[model samples]
Target chain A: MKFNHRHVLSMEQFSAADIHAVLDTAENFLELNSREIKKVPTLRGRAVINFFFEPSTRTRTSFEIAGKRLSADMLNLSGSSSSVVKGESLVDTALTLRSMNPDIVVVRHSHAGAPHLMARHVGAHVINAGDGQHQHPTQGLLDLMTVRQRFGQIEGLKVAIVGDILHSRVARSDLIGFQKCGAEVWLCGPPTLLPPEFARFGARMTYNLEEALTGAHVIILLRVQAERMNSAFFPTAREYSQRYGLNSEKLKWARKDAVVMHPGPMNRGVEIDPSVADGAHSLILRQVENGVSVRAALMMMLLGGGDRPRGDA
Target chain B: MSAGVREPVQVMNRRDFGRALDRLAHEIVERNQGVENLALIGIRTGGAFLAERLQKQIGKIEGVKPLLGIIDITLYRDDFANGLSNPVMGPTEIDFSLAGKKVVLVDDVLFTGRTVRAAMDALMDHGRPTRVQLVVMCDRGHRELPIQPDYTGIVAQTTRSENVKVRMKELGEEDGVWIEPPRPRTLPVAVLPPPAKERSKRKK
Candidate 1:
């Protein structure tokens, strides 16, 4: 199982074996993360540039920590801070960064295929941090790692992803990733938020949140993309909370050992109840902690010769 | 010998392997002057198994168990950028501090000494040891780095290109040391493209 892809732009690019490689490598990094001196000299003398054209907290910090931990010289440039705000073309910016000879370029943009465009222009390996509503591959990977840590294996488990699937890059990536691992994926939200087209992706779609949560091993709550929504997707926040939001009452619909997850910057009252978010079943913080390990594994694969075939001794 | 395949010449049998380990374990204990504050850190895969066996052997002799740890040198390899294939990473478990302990770095086979260099650097990251000693079951002669094993079980002279395998029972192999000849390289079958004149004729 060679992780031959130089640039990780989507979960669609990952086969089951390739996903295993990432997860397996991340497992080692998870151990490294728990070390007293949580750092490795793997990517020494390598340069990494985190170019985020959108706002992020967890993703940016995770990538930064991962690079620093691997001993890679890291440079972070945000949309407001960089020349992207000055009307510099994406290709020109990428070319300029390429001239500086960064070994890895992590891109986060509001537009879809932005990282793909960056990869086309830059010689450095490109990792799509999050490209609009298209894909957040690393987040999907950490979620997989978190679930795998809890359950040991991903096969034959029901994963229910609730809320705003239409405006979520996480939804797209997780749907592909979980299904690839042989998990039955269920998408549940309001009709406007959950499209029937998602069913084409081999996920079971349900308007009733209770039905989706029923017999679920893992439940992932997506943040309502209020910023992306232009019109009313639901009657009100209160009504949506009562219908689709995962509170203590709705939690009973799932199995006794059912674990809950949320891609962070979560709407506490609107999307999930605070009690459930901080409950025993919640793996939200564990997912955040695994983010660094997963990103470190990605950097090691792309820059540390992890993806290449073994050369003769 | 078959085409592109090399046969291994067995140098040590299962009894020889056990005797070598028993001797190596005794030597490590004698050199360190008792097992107090002595920790054994093994390199991953083969070295890890050898370290475990040595730990038990030493415990039986000295009537006290030493602290044991395992270090994976895949991250610390200088050949990382040189396109060495991604080695499957195992957990590096150094739970105890190396601050005051006499660390015995154990390995199965010492060839390039590059692995030892990486292992030492990896060990330092955990904590600085009082003193570090190297121990190996087999020391096949090929030193890329200026590093030498302090306590060697067997020293074998071999060409740089030869492969020395230390098969262990723990890794699902019979205990033995074998010198394997390099595999014969197969000639690549070249595929010639059609001539330009033939291509022009095909267009008609």
Candidate 2:
């Protein structure tokens, strides 16, 4: 199949082959890391905009790195820093950016489907970094890539995703990604945080932390959104951590090869015990590192440089 | 089926294959300064196996283990809907850090560049890398996307009708390369010219 111009707004839009193409291209791009000159001129003449309506450190930085590596001129527009304070609507903001003739626009918004809406109005390729709790397709792919790299294959791997699944876009994206990549996904959290319909996606639901971790091949711990506590989902942070926290003792229930991962801004003592988060099995840092390569791959593909191979071959 | 033409199947032997991988490894190390702050990611199936081999060779030469990642670009392909009844996903492995690291993307062959496009989508969730370079065993040409291989072992010029097959001992039973000629399609035989007499009789 041929991909000329396309917008990536959701994980649902990807087919198995589509996913394979992105992964394969990223694999080839990874080779660039070993070079003395890390930057490539593939997307040098292209322009990219990082439109983030939500505050993010990891994601924003990753997209910036990806754009810079591809040699595309990058623009960072944050809601707080931009003219949104002057009363510009998202549609207007997107239209203004589109007028700038960008080759790609990476968006992170607080509203679900915001990227989808923006994509309809833009000539540039739109990449959804995160949208509310709906989906983070790129995050899902990178998480799957991380897990697969640790383990030879994802088939039949027992993966337990714990913490605030209710407000986690990462959880939702990882759920889809893990299941699609052949991993058995398990969702564990308080009843309020764990939706009843989660099982429909082929994931096993559990409220007990120990049981969820039992013999699991991979453990993905999502960051607990403290702001969501205002709704009385959990009584207190300490109480919540006691019931569902992944500590050293609980870590023993997972398989020997079991690895623990977290999407950053980690609450050291809340969602995961410090010992476990810093332990040898923790791939948390690895996740952060992979985020760059993955984002770079995404930008290259969306900007039309991904399809081209690098160097003087 | 095309007059006197025969389908071609040319083989690339083991010694030549090993040399190809060695050269790729050397190129990767020289480019990235001995694998420090570097990673190797492979496409699923053959690409992943090739990445592992390259990593092993690079590790021996560099004296430091390079992070190896495997990616399955199944959902990122362009022709996904036309191929399968149900999507078949492969594994993606990248245990090492990607942030601020130079990444080498390894694949068996570079053809239409569709696979590399998908692999890029899959790589983003992990983190961000300092850079991404593409390495392939064979550059078969005729790329649909603007993608170009950074480090290509061999540049084999092939027609659109030709098929390139890469076999590795880790994934396949043998290690070799084969080029096969495209098969021509036969036209459907006319059944009595659609019964012209019947059509005229019906008209009468």
Candidate 3:
């Protein structure tokens, strides 16, 4: 099948086959990463723009590494720029960036669906790094790649996502992505942080973290948005951690082999204790490593080149 | 009536394919002078199988195997953008370096030499080989580049209007070469020429 879309705007844009293709491609890139030179000229001389309208360290750095590894001319644009600070519209920003002739644009914006709008107006392939609380596709995919790598298969696995669901773009993307891959999903947190409508996407919702962790194959802890603490979403950080925090004792309820995952900037004492975060179950760093491979795969797929790295390049 | 179409006709069967590979192995060793510093790299899919078969033959004769690599030149092709709308990526599995070794590049057919050109380009990326030799199962005429096979099993003469296909036993049951008829052109029928019978009648 044709790689159905050019712009990777959301996890919703991916079908099961699309996910499979991404996984398969990511595997090749992982193999490539073992080489001594560890570089491919597939995107050599092509221009790439990391147009992040939101602040990020990992996603932006991972994308920069991925593009640079492919030898693409990469430029990073964060929200702190003078033009963006002067309040130029997203359309104007995208048009100005497009004028510089980027072959691909990785956009992370505060407003949701910003990448989709930029894709419609520009000629470059737009990869949504993250958009508000809507989606973070690459993170969802890297999580999937890491899980699939550990379990040998995604289908029939039970994945439990604990911590904030209402405010998490990661949670939303993962719920849809895991369901699409045939994994059962459970969302656990306080009712204020857990959306009932998330069950509409096939994830079972519960308030009790222990109930969610029971018999699960993978447990993902999302970092609590501390900014939301001021908004009365929860009574306090101590209460939230005491109720939903993943400590070693609570982790025992999960299968012994259950993978503990967190899309990080970890809150050591809040959503997860330091012992659990640093324990054997943690896939935090593997997720970061897979992050580069998965992004490389996505960029390569978007460029539509096969295994043949450019000869002259 | 024979007017409608012409089908693919098999030229060399599976047994002949084996014999050809067996002979090509001897040729490769003879040219390179006893496989010293020799390595074999196959162009993916068809050539990979051929490379392995050659390895087995070389092992049987020389009592050792040359280093083996398989290259998939999809990304290296010149028409990477315009030619393939959705290309399925395969891995380039050259684990060892080509520092100063004599490399033999293998493929099923030598047609336009584009595949070989791409393979050479891909090999240079791994590191410069001291020498590179081309080994093809079939050398069908209609060259678009100045590339000729160092060792060829069969020379199947063909025109630009025809297509040549090479199949291996590893891929399926039958192993042979087939030539396909040309596709019909899309030019308007109004630009006319008299039929032979009509020309004879006019002459009479």
Largest DockQ belongs to which candidate? 1
* TM-scores for all predictions: 0.94, 0.63, 0.88
Candidate 3, position B122, lDDT: 77
I-RMSD for candidate 2: 11.7
Cα-based lDDT at residue B195, candidate 2: 77
Number of backbone collisions per candidate, in order?
A: 0, 81, 2
Q: In candidate 1, which residue pairs clash?
A: none
Evaluate residue B32 in candidate 3 and report its C-alpha lDDT on the 0 to 100 scale. 89
Error of 1 at A123 (Å): 0.9
Error of 3 at B171 (Å): 1.0
Off by over 4 Å in 1: A228-230, A306-313, B1-7, B186-204
Candidate 2 residues A1-313, lDDT tens each? 4443367777777765566566655655665565444565556567888988899988999889878887778888898899988998888887788778877788999999998878877666788999998999888877877887888677789999999988898999888877776778889999999988888887899999888999999999988886875668898889888998889888999998899999888998998999999999999988877777777767655544342211111
After superposing all C-alphas onto the true structure, candidate 2 shows an RMSD in angstroms of 11.0
Error of 3 at A182 (Å): 0.8
Tens-place lDDT per residue, model 1, A111-229, is 99999988888888899999998999999999999999999999999999999998899999999999999999999999998889887898999999989999999999999767644
Estimate the Cα RMSD of every predicted model relative to the unseen true structure. 3.9, 11.0, 7.5
Summed over model 1, clashes come to 0
lDDT of 3 at A263: 95
Indicate the DockQ of the complex predicted as candidate 2: 0.05
